[model samples]
Every structure is written in structure tokens, then in C-alpha cells.
Target: MFHSPRPLVAAAAVPIAFGRAGVLRRPQPRFNLVVDLTQQPFSKRWWRGLATLTALVAGVSQLAPPLGALPAGTPVAEGSDQARQEAALAVGALSQGSATGLTMSEGPLARPIVSAPARQSRSLSLIVSPGDDLARLLGRNGVRVADALQAAALVRAEKALPAPGTTLSLRLGAPDGAGQRPIEHLQYRARLDLELVISGSDAGLTVERRQLGLDRTPLRIRGSVGGGLYWALRSAGASPTQAADYLQAIGGSLDVGSEVMPGDRFELVVAQAKSADGRTLSGGLLYAGLERSGGSDLSLVRVPLGGKLQWISETASPEPVRSGLLTPVAGPITSGFGGRMHPILRFIRMHKGVDYGAGWGAPIVAAADGQVIRAGWTGGYGRQVRIAHEGGLVTSYSHMSRIVAEGGFVRRGELIGYVGSSGLSTGPHLHYEVLKDGVPVNPLGVTMVSRPLVDNRLMAAVRARAKALRGL
Candidate 1:
């Protein structure tokens, strides 16, 4: 029988049955009784206990080491070697402010060190000097002897070596273990329009010739004659060859030595040929003019006729012949063409020609258009050169430092030699002579004539070209 349940009490338990046999019974329900601590008189003591417990937990955490932190000498479990190592590393990092085998720094991270490789190639430039051949020049610039010789042989087989003052660009290989750097590549100008490139290694050498195109551009310049015509032209940006050509063109009418004075104004126009890379190749005078102080202005224009270029006057009037022979050198007459007391022999002798006193190496030019018949050393005349002109006329120049035109058809005012005292001479001077049929004669007494003008048809074209050039 189920008796009435006892009245619920503060600490009492209660249960209920389900089946008649009491096989299923309900569990006693638990009661969590919470009192109002704020209302209790001992509530302050309870809060104090909680505070103390929290303080104790915090103090223990502070005193114990971290999980991954252990002292170096601390013992560890046998199967926890890795864990022990990690703990030791952590402990070291904390103590030293950095991990083991690493330092804390305030800069970029260090990179791995590496060894530099050996140099394979280098570039160098060499200027050709006098008496310098390809082999010698390369040898002087640190090229291996055998390699230089082989390269020189290859270059000579393909083309002539570059002239003096020519710059050669070279690529050199690094020195081997034997301390030998070989020429790997060589480049130099073969001609004004051609360049030679040579490249090789230990295997063999290769040669290549490259052609350079030229561009012709017009140039005009004006200046006053100072010191001389050559100096004046050079001052106005004319090359030595151009200045000589200009003088030769006007030689038929103007005497450069005596007529050209200081302050003489001049103007010139030329077509200059330059390589694609801006190197000057050659130049040709298209027009030239000179205005003397008290004389009429002289103008010359280059005109094409009979497949050749000729310098003619702008006007139709026939070109005038030069009054006298062009002086060979710009020097005073030191000895006249007559008998004189021989300075060395101390005897009266017949001096065949006149002597012009000049410094050594002064340029001596042909007095008229002629062909060189003799150019070599003569006993008393020193280094002599004889040129045969038209109408059985011949001129001789002696005492030269060097002969420029040995045997060639030379025009009037052409450089033939430089003044020198090679043979019997007291000082540097030019002994000039004029001969008729191999007999010496007085040069100052004879007169020179100019050549005839071109055909009238050619002259018409020349006049037209001059007009167009002058913008008339």
C-alpha cells in the first residue's frame, strides 16, 4: 500500500513506483538549495574565501615554469628527447632574448655567402703607333704571344694592317691558369668605307669585312687669312689635304706665298663625305673665293667635264695665267742664281740655282705642273727631286728632309718635299733651279703661262651650276 508521502523538508528525499511489482521506480529528485547570501549575516566571510582561492591559483601559476620552458640541467622522460630539446631551446631563447645559435639584431637578415666566378672576357682599346704592326700592338696590350701571331697572320691574309694612328678595338679573354690572356676579337677600320672584324678562340680564327656607307653633306665656312693660307684654311676647319687641294685649284691665277696676305677674307664650300657613324671620310671643294684688300675677288667653281672635275671661274672670261712662277717655299732668297763663294770649299763657284732660307721640315711645293723625273739623294744637292714641266722646262728642288712625291704626275703648288739639309749644306734651305734641256737657267727670268679654258659647251654648264650654287 502507498502511504501518503511525507511532507517535504529542507534535507529530505522522495521516490515514486510505477509497476505492481515495483520493478520500475522513479529516481529521487535532487534539490540544489541556494540561500540569499546578501541577506545572510556571514556573507562577507563567503566572499573573502572566494577571493583567497583566486589569489592562490594566480600565485601558483606565476611560480611554476611554462610547459615548453625547462632549465638546462633539468631531468626529462626517456621517450621525450625532442620535447626536452624544444623546452631547452625555449628556455635559452627567454634567457638570452633570442633562440639558440641566433642573435637578435636590428638590421636586414643575413644572406648566404657565395664565391664569385672567374671573369670570362674583357674589352680594351689600343692606338696604333709608328712602327707598330698588328702582332706587336696586340702583344703590347697583354695578348698572348701565340694568339697575337695567329691573329695577325689571319688578318694579314684577309686585309692589310691598319695604318698608324688608327684605333683598334679588342676583346680579350680572361687569363687561363697559366696567366695567358688571348685576343678573342679585334676590330679596326680597313679603309674609309670598309672595316675588318676578326674573332677567334682556341679553336680557330674568323675574319669578316664590313662595308660602311657614306653620306655627303655640304659645308660652308669663311675666315680671314692669318699667318698664311694653310693656317687660315685650317683655322676655318679645313683638313690639311683640303687646304692643299684648295691652293692647287687656284694656283693657276694666285701665288699663294706672295699674294696671300694677312686679313685677306675668304669663303669656301665643300661636300664632305662621312661614314654612317659620323666619321669623316673625304671632302671635295665645290666652290672657293678670296677677296684681297685692294684686288678683285677671285672665285673658283668645280665643274664636271669629260668625266673629270675641273676648277673654273664663275664668269665666262677665260682664266688668266699666273704672272710668275708660284714660289716653292715661303722663305726669303738666301742665295741668288749666280756665282758665289762656296761656304765649305772657300772657293768661287757657279751656283746654279737660288736658295730660299727656311726652317727644317718646311713644306716645299712644285712651282708648276710637271712630272717627277728624279727623286733621290744627290751628292751636293742633298735629297733632290726634279720635275719636268711643259715646253722643255724643268725645275729642281734640293736639300729636303723628306721627298713626298717621288714619281708621279704632280700639279702646280703640289707638295713635293720638305726643306732639309741632308747633303752638303750649312743650314736648312731649299736650292731651287730652272733648267732648259738639262741646262740650268735663272728661274726669276722665265715667265709661266696658264692652260686654255674648257669647251664653250662645258663652260655653259659650269656657269649654270655656279648660278644655282650662288642662288642667283
Candidate 2:
């Protein structure tokens, strides 16, 4: 190794001396290192040895007390500069400091360097599945992408999309939660990333599924009569349209107002719609069945006929039979069949049928199915309609109110005549009568056929048509 001159050193020490006058006097000490090889006659080898000893003693003295006791002409070695640097480094390593420094000036340090610990984990995750659009799913889950293109950009950046599989992952460098500021800590840890998964599989294809709940829809309502069938339906929240249809269904044979009794009840099956999120929107159809106390059970059925559905009476046949006549001007029937003797006639005339009392202009509905044979003002009864029945029976409505267009097949319940006191000893009352096989009989006592009498072939055809109409 090449030799170098001695290193120069300077030191200053101030001693505080106490004087007899009680005043403190500061005496400063000074030191400096100077090499004058030109003025020396000694060999370099001798100087080198001296310098090595001086360097050892000086360096060792740094770790001891009374550092100023070193000899007066202490020589420093050629590598004294490196030795001083090393000592300084050792002291620095023992002391705590703000700026971290490594002991690798020569090369990398031989000892393992320990680094500070991590405050939190940076891994974050987001889960997605099939049926979820990139933009929409991100938006709903508190992940934001400006638009479809931006969403695609995010997907591309993460290599996640389309096919159901693992999607995205991110190693964050800071602590985080939703809508929160991130911070660094030495003890806390968190993981963040996105995971895409296939929710379901069927026939070699992946599918997505979700569960949702729905709310109840509003109730429907309608018009009805008394605490009977109609009233029961109304209380059950049936709509007006439903009520009208129900009335039309049972109105034919059953007199709704008079037939229904107390304690009647009904049940219905309603249809409704649901939203994508499973919220009930509204309801529609109100199919129902009803039962009346002291009365009969009722049901509504849509009977098909020639590709069309029609409401038909289930309790009785839709057809009615006609076989009777009435006298004029019967305002209100003072007597009916099977009643006591007449108040005016006294001699027990034995009423053959129910009498309907009405004023001279009151119209009369046809009692049953028949054809009008005579319709005019006859000698005994003023205006009249004599309808001939299916079994050689004839009926007449006698009165002066007036007669409708005659000489045609009249259906049951058709208006035929008006009420009047003509050709009879009655004041505005209808003389109603029924005849069987051309013989007078009590109409109330006769049992009329419930259903229309049709040929077997025609009935079969009708049934087939009805079935087709019902689509069943």
C-alpha cells in the first residue's frame, strides 16, 4: 500500500475555572495535527510504525476517558483516514436516527437488513356473475365506470368479462373502505380484488340467478245487492266489472234480490302482475264461488260456444215454457193459487193462477216460450195476446193497456200485452190462466220443463261447439 501523510485533526475544549473573586473564567483548549516530513532525518519505516501505534491509541481512547492523555508526537498511519470513518459508522449504527443509512460503503453489507413492516394488505376484490352487465353491476355494487366504453376499458385492463370466470384483482398500496379516505398503518391489514363467477350451469351453458320478494297488489271492487251473493262479493273486494258479470251469470232463473238470504259467503281467485324485482303491480280476473244459507250454491263458468265463451245458468235450464192467459187491469194480485176465498166474489172461485194487478197502461211480459196465435181486442177481453204453447196449450194476457206486434214466435219473458179492465169484471187487473191439452189448469201447480228440448244430434253438436269454444 502507498503511504500518505498524517491526517490533520483540530479540537477545542473550554474549561470553566473558579476564581477567588467568585467569578467563573472560561479557559479554552486547542489541538491540531501537522506533518513536517521535510524537517525530519528519521527513516520512513520508523515513521510508519510510530504512526500505526498513534492511530491505535487515539482510536481506542475515543472509547475511554481523559481523551487528551495521548503522547505529544503521535504519528498517524497511511490508512488512518479509513479507520476513522469505520469508527464513526459503528457509533452511528448504535444511535437512533430519523434518516435511515446502510453500512455498505465498501460493498453490500454482509448482515441481513431488516425493513419496516407493512401497515395493511393491499389486495381488494369485487365479485360478479352472469346476467350482470359490466357497467350496471359496477354501478349497483358501488363501483363506478363512466359509460359502457369505460366499463369495457376497465374490463380490458383487468382482462375480465363475457365468459363467467375470475374477473379482476387489484393490489392496493393503502387502507380503504367504501367512500372512505385511505391511510397507512403499521398494524392494520385489508385485501381488495374482484371475482367473477358462474352462478348456475344447465345443458353445458352457464346461467345467473337472483332471489327477490314482492308486495301485495290493490284489491278490486264492484256493484251487488243486499247481504246476499252480491254483497258478499263486494265485501271481498271484487271489482265492478266482475260484479256485473256475476249478476248476469245467475240472474236468468234466480231473482237475485228475493232469492238471496242472510249468512251467505263467497271466495275468489284473482290474477296479478309482478315486476322484475318481484313487486306486485296490480290484479285482474276475479273468479269466484258463492254459497247462500237457506239458498243454493252458485258458481260462475264461462261456457264455450262456437269459439266464444258465454255465461249460462247452472242452477236451471236457460229456456222457459209458456201456457197461460190473463184478464185485464189487474193492478196487484189480491189473490193467488191455493189461497182463501175471494174477498169480492165470496163464493170461493178457487183461483187457478197468480194474478198480477196493474193499471190500464201496464205492459205484460210473456210468461213462457210460445207463438202468438191471436193478438187484438177481443169482445170479452180488450187487447190480448193468445200464445200457443209446445203441447197444444194456449195462454192469453187480457187488458186494455195495449198489444205489441203479434203473430210471431215469442220467447219467454217477452212483453206481449198491457194491463186494462176490458171485457171482464175487474178493475185494472190481469186475469192470468194456464191450460193443459186445451183444458184449464192451475199454472203454479204445473211443473214446467227446466231445459230446452232439443234433438239428440243437435245437442251433441252443441256440446262439441261449446268444448271448442272453451279451448279445453
Candidate 3:
């Protein structure tokens, strides 16, 4: 669908075709065409068909024609009551010429057509974001408050909402004087987030917060505590140009899902390739730092290790050991495990596990190192996945955009699925549940145990380095 507010041609009686050169092509002549007119003294179909044939043969089907001309086609009926009637009408129409001041071969009837509005010549574009109040954003851009509200209302009616955190584009026209061009229009995608209470009443509100940020030379990326990670970073001002580049460089280098936490932090050195005319072409991560929620930090340096680019980490921490309970998605818990009424169907049922709020199709990560037990649709769960962790502990994820890899063993941080609101869900959320011995357990209550880097050799070196940094 086009995001711009360009003029659209109305549905025409004669369908128009196009060519490889983007030019509108004329319709091909309908060979062996037939017409019937016996039933009615002056039949509309007979005249219309005759006009079409003439127009097609003349190569000006779009133009109107006068009455009285020859009918060029014959009818070959294939046995039916309607066919017999059609044959009679065809014979009658052929015998009579100009009986109603209209002839078959004359041409199409002349009818006045409304002219299209003159198109304004200007550049156009659209920018969409999550949680941006369209009217307020437009108002800030100098549009009148009333006009902004009207525009937003129109867009909402158009159902142009993109998935949460996903950016939807609109055509932007060049500015005219102090305001945007009259042809300019903007739209915001629709997105919703859910919040759950750990210990609160139904009449109240509970809020949990998480934040991830880092400002280092050459690179800056911020992760959110509750919204879709990609969307949050984008909304917080991370450029798509840079984020996409970073994702491309480190795509398989790390599992962003399992490694991300509410307080996760990141910093990196990015190198940009530039043109002599001061245009930036591309860039990639050169060095980086990432810290998880439990204080596990990984330093990344891209260097020629064995004549190949390799990621080297210094000051390795053991807190991020493969526990296999980590999920690829990072954000706040939107829905919690419990029996409640269904959001859409209003059915009373049990919802197992907590759901992480995120954009539809957001990548889902393996919670821990485990082999997949199930990865397919389950009735009300839509696309579901079950993974078996250590000690007979199993985790389940439901309602996914897709199962990337399924029914296969995976490490603690491998990509397994994507976020979605399929099945009985009303919006995008990662429905995650943990079960032990076929009984559900509160995932949040289970503490994630990590093998701290407390090795004697590593500890001694770290202690010595700390002492040296302190000038001891």
C-alpha cells in the first residue's frame, strides 16, 4: 500500500493494463466476441459490445463513438435456455441497423467524465514510530492543532498501524514557505503494551522499569526496559543506518535475545566509510562492550586472529554462563501466568507463564541450553514451542510470528522463535512458561544460577589488576 496521499484512479469499466516501461497499455481486443439483443427492443449489452469491438479495432477504445455501424462478430451458443435466447437476440440485432438511433459498430456512448484534481509537484515521505501521539507530533512540526487532529483521525481510520516498534514510512512533500506542503500527510502505526502486577489489586496500577544505555566514543546504543528493544532504541534516537549496520556485523556473533536484560548496557567503536564529497557510505562495529542484567560484561575487539577477523573479549565474567534459562527477547513482563478471562474471546481460562511485551516478529531466544521438545501450533497457542532445560525443567513459548528452527537441540542462547499475537492473544507478547515435573512454577521466583569466574588463576590475576589500578 502506498503511504503517500496521491491521487488514485477510480475503478473503470474497462480495466487498464501496464507495460514494462511503466506506461499504461491498451486492452487487447476480445476475439470471437458475440452480442445478443432479441429479448429487449433496445438492449444495452448489444450496443455496448458493438461499441467495444469498434473501439478495439480502431485503437481508440477510450474515445466515444456515434451510432450506426456493422457488427463484426458471430455467436456460437453451446446448448442452454439462455444460449437459445442469446442466439435469437444476436440474429435480431444483426438484422436491424439504426433501429434506436444507435448502431453496434458506431462507437461507445458519449458520457461526461469528471476531471481529476491537478497533481502538486513536490517530494513526499512518511515517518512512523511507536507510541508517538500523531496529533501532538504533527503539531510540534508546526501544523495547526486542529489539522493535526483531523489528519491523525483519518490515518487511524485507514488502518495504517505498523507492528509495535516498527517504523512505517509515508511520502513527504517539499515544504512550502513556513509550513509543509499542502500535499504532505503523516501517519503513526498502532501499537499496544500490556503491564502485569506481581502483587497488586485489580483497582490499581503497577509499574516495573528497566533501562539499558551506554555513551561511548564513536557508538551509542540504548536499550529499553519494557518496550520492544529495537523500537525503543529507534524511538530513543538510534539511527536505523547505524543499528542495522551493527546488527549485520554481529548478527551471528551473539544472541541479542538471551544476552539482553533490563539493565543491560552497550558501547562500541564504529568505523564509517565516507566518500570524498562528505557522504557516508557504510559502517560496522570495530570494538564493543556489552553488559547483561546480572552484571556479566563482554568486551569485543575485532582483530586479525589467525589472519581472520575475530571477536576477542577481555575481563571475561562467568555470570553469563550458559544456564539455558535465558530467553532471546528483552523487555518487561507484559502478561503474567494465571487463570483469567481471555482478552478477545472473553473466555475464562488459565494462561501459563509470563509474556514479554514486544513487536510482532521480534526474535525469540532459547531460555537455556536445551533440546526442543515441540515447535508447532497448539490449539489456542497459535505457533508454540517447548524447550527442555536441565533437571527436567521445561519452558514453553507460544504465539509466534514463526519458528525459525524447530524440533532441534539448541544452546542456551540460540534463536528459536519470533514474537507474535496469534491464537488467542490480542497483541504481540512472548507467552513464556516454565514447568517442572509437569507442574507449572513461577519463572521469576526461580533464581538463575551462574558459574562466577572465581577460578583461582583468573581471580588472582583480576585481584592483581584491581590492586594495580588502585595504585596499591
Candidate 4:
């Protein structure tokens, strides 16, 4: 038993006051405890009470759960941007439509701290700046690094990520304890004809590509070759690729610069695709026509014939054999193949081949792709090389300075010999002769086979289509 003087314990009430402005002010609790011990200091009973309090606090701490690290969208320091943001968040906690706050869900330490929103989740507009990729845009806006990486990787799987200068609409879900918003849904224009929608859930992200409606039609354009055909097409709303392909399709022998006068009417039909809003996306040329007032019109079409797609001339005879022969040398005809006086012998005789007055030692290419059957020195034609082309058409090149190809196959335009007064020549010239079954024929004539003829039904179909394009 402890014998001591009695101690006094009392309860006090805090007084409330009213201001002169007629406002009621409530007083906060003033728990200023006063302990009056009537016994001497250092009592065993006092020590026992302190020990019990310490033990109770220790037990409570041991029963509590461990805490997880708080997620920070960015690094934080005093007087830093993060600090300012924290202050904003503090003020926003009391109001609606402000910076977000956090609320502990279930067990405080182990469970996640969900974002207690000021209002319902709404899609925020973010304009894609120049050179800003998906990951960079999302991360800069407080999205988790993990979520951004996952979304980007999924988009790259289908095609490259959307280019810059685009708009992305996103719905953000509640942020975790780490201040990063998880993506709820995102819509992006992956391409002119494609749209992508990305959705995120606890089970992970899912990506879907939706094809936009497209209107495909043949783009027929006709205009005068004012200034130039190329620029005229561009001025008439033709794409660069479409106009270039049209010129190339008609470039076999017809020169667009000199032959297509400014007065000529140029017509072009190209494959084009357009959006519902009338945005153009065009492909190569399908037909190119040149209408001339002085001469016959030139018309060309790219159509399938004999199981192969090939160029067809609508004006000229079908499959002209003249297209097969390539000029053996570059020079004007010095002598014709018909009867004429031989230049060297000075006598009237039949000239079997045409003579080309080329420069000395100039390159002489193969007339066409063929195998060299007869080469080396001949009777009168010095340094002669004879190559046999397909369809029994044999071409002989005489008066060459030297021969490089004696045997084996040679391609057209390959340097086979150099021009010189080798044999039967009085000057530096190339004597080109075309023979059919050992009989000399006109070298400039269409001396080869024609292309596979188009069927009657297919020709009718092509003609009808061309007529449709030619109509006003």
C-alpha cells in the first residue's frame, strides 16, 4: 500500500465568444493538463504507469502493416515544380475541378491509394506537338512510364506510330499511389485510311485498328499543254507521282517536250482513292492520251494481255515489230541499201547494207540481244561481227576497228566493237546489214516478231474502256 496526500483532478470548459461583427466563433479545445502530485518525486507507482504506456505504444506499432513507397510522377524537392504542384493539390483538395487528391483504399499501407477525383473522368485534349512521339507525349502528361511503353509497343506492332501534328483523345482512369494516371481509352488516326482505338484494363491493354471508309475512282484529267504537260497536270490538281508516271508511260519514242506542243490537249487517267471528306491519295497512271490537231492522236493504255500486263498503242498497228530493233550505232545514213555507186570503187553497184559515218574509234553496240555466230575478219568487211537475233534475224556489223565479243551471248547496248575503217571501207564508218535467212533485207524496216496479239474479246473491252475515258 502507498500512503500519500490526495491529488486533485478537475474538468474545465472553454468559453465561446461572439464578435462585434455579429459572427459566432467557437473556441477550440484547450487541454492544458496540470498534474499536482502531493507525494515526493521518484515514486515506484509513477515509474510503473510510464512503463505501461511505453509497452502499449510498442505493441500497437508491431501490429501495424508495412507501408509501400508513394508513386511520384516526377522528382520532388523544396521550392521545385513538384512542390508548387503539391501546393496546388493541397488547395484543390478542398474544391471541385482542381488538382487531384489521393484516398487510401482498404488496408492503408499495402493497398493502393486511388485518386479521389474532383469530378467524373473526362477526356482531355492534347495536341501532338512537332516531333512528339506517343511515349514522350504520355509521359510528359503524368502517365506512367510502364503504361506509355506498353501502348507504344502495341501501336508499333501494326504500323509505325502516328506521325506528328495529330490530335489524340484520351480518357484517364484513377491514378495509383505513384501519381501516374492509367490510360482508360485512347483514339488516334494511324493513317489516312485507318484509325486506332486503344483501351486499357486490369487485364492489360488491347489495340484495335478500324478502317475508315474510302472512295476509289479513276481520276480523268484533260488540259492543254500550256507551259508544259507536266506542270499543266500539276496545276489541274494532279499529284506529283501521278503526273510523273503519266509522262513515263508515254515516253518510248514520243518526246513530250518537243512533240507535245502547247496547243495539244493532254489527257490522263490515274487510279485514285479519296476519303469521305475529299482528301486525295492517288496511284500510277492507267491511260495517257495526246490529242494533236495536225497529226494522228497518240493513245496508250496499260492493260493485261496474254497473261501479262504490257504497254499497248491505240493509234499505231497492234504490236509493231519496229519496237524490238535498237539502233546499232549513233550516226546518219551515209549510204542507202538500194542500188548506188560504191564510194570506194566508184562504180554503180547494188549496196546490200547502209553505211553510218561515225567518228573513228567510236563505240559500236549490239543491235539487239543475241548470240555472236560469225565474228573476226571476213571477205571485204574488215573487223566484222555478226550476231544472230531471235526469229532468224541476223545482223552484221562491218568496218569495226576491233572486236571485244567473239562468242557467247551479248545484250543490247553492250559495247561489242569500236567503229573503224577495218575492212571494205574507204573511211571511218559503220556498215550495218540486216539479213533474213542469208538474204539481205532492209535494216530500217520492222524486221522482227510482233508482241503476243490481244484477243478479240479483250481488245473490244479495252477499246470500250478507252472510249469511255476519251468522252467529254
lDDT of each: 0.79, 0.51, 0.57, 0.75
Candidate 3 residue runs with Cα over 4 Å from true position: 1-287, 291-297, 300-313, 317-332, 344-347, 407-413, 452-472
Misplaced by over 4 Å in model 2 are 1-222, 226-252, 255-294, 297-332, 336-354, 359-363, 453-472
Misplaced by over 4 Å in model 4 are: 1-137, 156-166, 305-309, 319-453, 470-472
Write the residue-wise lDDT of candidate 1 on 1-472 in tens digits: 8999987765335455578886877664443233344554456655665566678889999999878955676444356555445555765334434234433345578554465466788898889888878888787777888888988897788766788899899998888766668777889997788899888766767888898897766677789998888888998888887787788777645677777789899877777778877787556878777889967777778876545565777654666454567789889999998999999889999999999999998889889878899999999888999999877989999989999999977767777889999899999999999998889999998787666556678677777766665552
TM-score of 4: 0.47
Pick out the ten consecutive residues of candidate 4 with the lowest summed lDDT: 31-40
Which structure is stronger by TM-score: 1 or 3?
Answer: 1
Better-scoring candidate (TM-score), 3 or 4 = 4
The clash numbers for all candidates, in the given order, read 0, 39, 24, 2
Please report, as a residue range, the 10-residue window in candidate 2 with the lowest summed lDDT.
183-192
CA lDDT of 23 in candidate 1?
Answer: 88
| Candidate maximizing lDDT | 1
CA displacement after TM-score superposition, residue 312 of candidate 1 (Å): 3.7
Off by over 4 Å in 1: 1-214, 275-278, 284-286, 302-310, 315-322, 437-439, 464-472
